[model samples]
Target: MLWFNPRHPSFFYYNTSTANLKSNYQVNTNGLIGQTTALQSVVSWNKTITKCRQNSQIIKAQKLFDKMPLKDIVSYNTILPGLNQAKNPEKVCQLFLEMERVGLKPNEYTLSMIFSAALNTELKLLVSQIHARTICLALNASVFVGSALMKAYADAGDGVGLGKVFNEIFNKDVSSWNALVSGYMELGRMHEAQKTFDTMPDKDVVSWTTLVNGYIRNKRINKARSIFNKITEKNVISWTVKINRYVQSERFVDALKMFVLMMRSDTMPNKFTYSSVLDACAGCCCLLVGQQVHSSIMKFGIPKDVVLSTSLVNMYAKCGDIDAAFSVFESVQRKNLASWNSMIGGYCRHGLGKRALEEFERMIKMGVKPDEVTFVNVLSACGHGGLVEEGEKHFDSTETKYGINAEVKHYACMVDLCGRAGQLDKAEKLIKEMPFEGDVVIWGALLGGCGHHSNTKLGELAAEAISRLKKDHPALFSTLTKIHGEKGARSTVVTLRKILNEKRFRKQEACSWVESPFHEM
Candidate 1:
């Protein structure tokens, strides 16, 4: 005979006493009697169901669960987590209701799983119902359940519901407090998030990190840094968040300095940290620092996943190291679309137009579909290499074959191709036939082509279109001045030069940087 404890319904105890041997009866908390053999069979079935779920065989687990002769709260609980893992929220809700209908009272674990599964706004009403049920079962005070409820409301963007759940928690732990703070952060209520952090009775690394991330998300980098500096013990996530924000804000120098500080503090850089650092290196063209970072990644034996590999390819390509970029691209075991795009873009950037086109063809032969970005690079490659026929073929294929509509940028590439090939009329016609209004870039491409081929008439038209878009563009005036000077139109040259002077237009001087031994720049 086996007896189940009321407080811990999942656990069973076998009766050793043989006083009622012939009857073979046992009394459990549920007031049910059964032979010990039947209880053993249930235990075996439960173990099998658990193993199936663990192996990601959720369908098998569900089938086994349905076939079980006896169903209890434990059986439902076991299957609920698998359903949640599979992201079948409807099934989770159905199972929960079924448990209720069968008089199987759910424990804290079941409620927590349900709350975690019902995350989106579509399940907001269901979350409220579960909250009410938790209260009815006197399980609302359970820290685990309360934290899950707080997170559900947080994800659903229900600030009031999240705050109410937080207040109702009997003994709030750091996780519950973090949930509340995270909720406020998600709602973009930074002041409340900060206040909650200020009043946390106890704070963990996650608590501090959450507040910092919230500030970063709200574009409050200075405040996030101030809080980060206050943390006595900083973890990898904290450092990564600060560094990533710097990279995003184009503060590449600051991002590098932070990476140096993170290394000084002996905090290991994860894949995300490395990705941001590589981007910073690419932004400033700091090849030396990028090389050192790459060495450290190898020294630390970091796994080069597809994302990190793509970043490496981009950094190398941007740093004028196309060979190295190609090497990294080759090493990527699973080349995704991003990896292919980075490699192709690198080739186009280096004036290796033929190589870029070849690689694009290779990417296609590998069964990789080209995206809009891929086509942009491809068209640019054709323009740079003076492959006008190839460029037109690709431009036509964008709509006819690939189903990708030609954007303005693609059309600009086509105009540049025709202009480079001394086909001024074709370039002008391409601009006129564009589906949308030609922007400054489209006109700029045609103007560049006209200047190259000394087509003063078309150059004048392009300059006029550019002036309508931007009244005082220095490049537009400068290019027009050159075209008029070449045509011996002194009066027109004087007028363009006078406009340049009146607008106080000065082209930004181009400069380059070389990496120095000094770490602090």
Candidate 2:
């Protein structure tokens, strides 16, 4: 009779009325059963490790891997990627060495992960060692490995190495081409990037976007737009890049027009797209356009994550709608540091120093740590509200309590704070005591205070410092002229005015935005 083994479903046992059956069965089946069970265990372990990695429990995955009684190449491959994801390049290299010690050879996937890990590290020697290994193993021909090597070399700024890897690819895919183009772009070699992009037989959305982004990075907006226009199939990323570059260039109107065109297309605008659009609205202070975007965001039912919520807060605040900004801030389920900073900045912009300070306190109470930007806004609020004591306390606490070294901008804020409260002597003393040399901003702050207090001597000193730093600064000469005139120095004012005329100095005209029924300007 043949009896099926339920535990090992694929195997069957033959039982007969013979005394030799037991020994025969054991001899034939023990090795096979043991191998089958071991294989099953490895597979099960791999699944658990993969689950741990997917859940971002990399430490748990490493622990499981350490406890494994048996490990194969697949086990190393599985855990190596998790370590790479965790940005532990040292651990990845260590495990790779361990694999070598255990007599396991790495496959293409292993080399790819190692190359990825190498990209994050600045160890040129480690990269060379890995490259030599790939050549020895003849795995350099692998498209996967080749692309990764190109990226690693690109990041190292080794154009020669990148070129060598690209030439060695056995079957060049679009990814390989894209990698080369991206490498050139990263190195700021736009000509080479364009040449490689043009030579590609097949182009995906990523390829197009990469080239466009490369042009934008190199500050070739016209070239970027030309490439963007040629893309037959434009994805959200493609459109977003164009719009974002427009915003960055301060071409807010162009960004809005692009957004309008993007909406007319089938591709839906994502959170990033909306963020850029909001920035454009803020730039021009177009409240109507901002409200329309807010309506669209609600209509699309997009989840207001921290980034999007923060963007909305900034837009509303900049467009002179503080109430709406605060409402958006309140609605955020999970507020981040940026969210708090934006709210505080909004209050400062509107001269609500007390409110801004209150918000800062609320942020600290909620355990959100303040960064350099946070303190800048807070100090500016103190300057606006004439809270000199409060500003000095926060400024001092920045380094002592928060461990954030006061930067030049922080010093400028302090100068402004003191200068505003008519403490011109204190402001000048602060500048002289600064560890770093005072810049034009610091001098300008002191000069403004001098002009307000009619101190011609200190004003001349501030003007001289400004002239030394920025010779062509029209505002410096203009402000200095005003200081001299206020001090009844008619001859000095006349000389400054003549110099300004000769230099063709003109102050930038300030403009305000107003919505009309027919159009906007």
Candidate 3:
């Protein structure tokens, strides 16, 4: 039965059945021939299942797995990976149990797949049991298995378990070190992550990038930059990390300068690089820089990625080029929720409240669901246009229609909407009945509304509420003082400044920056 013919050297071509054998295809039929044929069928099934899995035909793979005549360790290994890839970890567990029931032992590959799936499943207890099994099977020394175990424990936030697995790894490679470092970073264990990076026998760009990113997360931007500058071979990602760090810190000028330097270099900018630079341009409202970025985007001929397109819309909008913003919005081949939100926000900012509302309606009709930001933009439009009824309807429908909970910003928009229409009582009532307490921004919104209506009484209440928050909002305080002065309350205005000075609440110094076309940092 285990015999191989000279003409047909493959197991798949080995036929033991007497009915199928011809003069040209000869086979020896022994007592083990039936078992050999069955084994051959199993092998064929395994190949089919593997092919199906590779093609991402998970359902078909499952069907093939279920219909197998006889399953073996190979069969289980073949299907388990596909199951894990499909995010069917529960199914993997069930199959593992089934393999055990049939007296089939899982190999190290099977254990690795389980750990990979378990990371996402958050099945910490199950992973623990699997770890014990790996130990009992004496497979813990495997670098592949050890890496997966480390990652699983890290994802579960089980740092101790991760360390134990790392200690047991016999041959730790760069990947192994990266997994542990990333794990430490994710858990905010910067010291431990840094220690691991320092002790690594070989450090790749990924290792450096991970530590740099960790420092950024911990708000150690200078340390991140210092580490970034030390990398001898800088990749696009390293440049992006620095650019992203600048963008996150609101250092728009620096971000744009980095981008310009990146463009001058041989390393081409990707979508993310363009996105960050566009964000900087938007922040600074630099139309020329934004237009330059727009031209680069065209020259690069990058695909219309949603994020890049949305950033372009935001850039143009913030630059006060509403027409260009709309043009970008319309040019988007597929407008996602972000694209719509940007357009609506652009309209709202330009005080084209009617157009913003129209876009909002069109968004809903086109079956694109509105998010919290969507409501924020639309409600803000309503406030600007004095559409109190529309604002109320949208606010009410936030939870019921869109399944989005009304956040503080949404409530602030509602308050502002009512206040804009001179419905001070309604605005006050809404604030009083809010689910959560108002923040400085919420009160500031109400105060601004009061200023617009010259409602000194409500303005006083709003100002008092803000004062109690003990925030250093100099602009709000200045506005309140101006409102009091207008209402013939000179003493009250003077007293407010005295209270501010007594509390040692000095106004924050405002700083702004612009990128120079001639000089690139």
Q: Every model's Cα RMSD, please?
A: 10.3, 9.9, 9.5
- lDDT, model 1: 0.83
Pairs in steric clash, model 2: none
Q: What would the per-residue lDDT of candidate 1 be over residues 1-521, giving only the tens digit for each residue? A: 34355765545444445453322134553533443556678778889999999977788999999888766667888899999876689899988887776556789999988888887737766778788999999998888988888888878777998999999988888999998898899789998998999999999988988898788777888988898899999888889878887888788998999999999999999999999999999989999999999999999999999999999999999999999999999999878778999999999888899999999999999877787999989988887798988998999999898788888778878887888789999989988888899878778788877877788999889889887877666777877888888889999999988988998988533210001111111
Q: Please, what's the RMSD in Å of model 2?
A: 9.9
lDDT of 2 by residue, 1-521 (tens): 22234455444333444453443245356756865676677779989999999876788999999998777778999999899877788899898888866556788999888888887576544776888899988999989999888888988888999999999988999999999998999899999999999889998998998898788777888888888899999989989988988888788998999899998987899999999999999888998999999999999997789899998999999999999999999999889889999999999888899999999999999877788999999998998898999999999999999889998878888888887798988999999899999877777777767766778888889889877877766666777787888778899999999999999988634210001111110
lDDT of candidate model 3 versus the reference: 0.80
**In model 1, where do residues sit more than 4 Å from their true spots?**
1-189, 196-207, 217-219, 501-504, 507-521
Per-candidate Cα lDDT values, in order, are 0.83, 0.84, 0.80
Clashes of each: 0, 0, 0
Residue-wise lDDT of candidate 3 within 1-521, one digit each (tens)? 22233454343232346565444234446524754776688889899999999976787999999987677678989999899877788898888888766555677898888888787565756777888889987899888888888888887888888889988888888988988887887778988998999999999898898788778777787888788878988889878877887888778998888787776777888888888889999989999999998898899897768899999999999899999999989988878888999999999888899999999999999877788889989998998798999889999999888678898878878887887688888888988999899876667677777876777888878878887874555655666776888888989899878877877776634310001120111
Model 3, runs deviating above 4 Å: 1-172, 186-188, 497-521
For residue 236, give model 2's deviation from the true position in Å: 1.9
lDDT of 2 at 391: 99
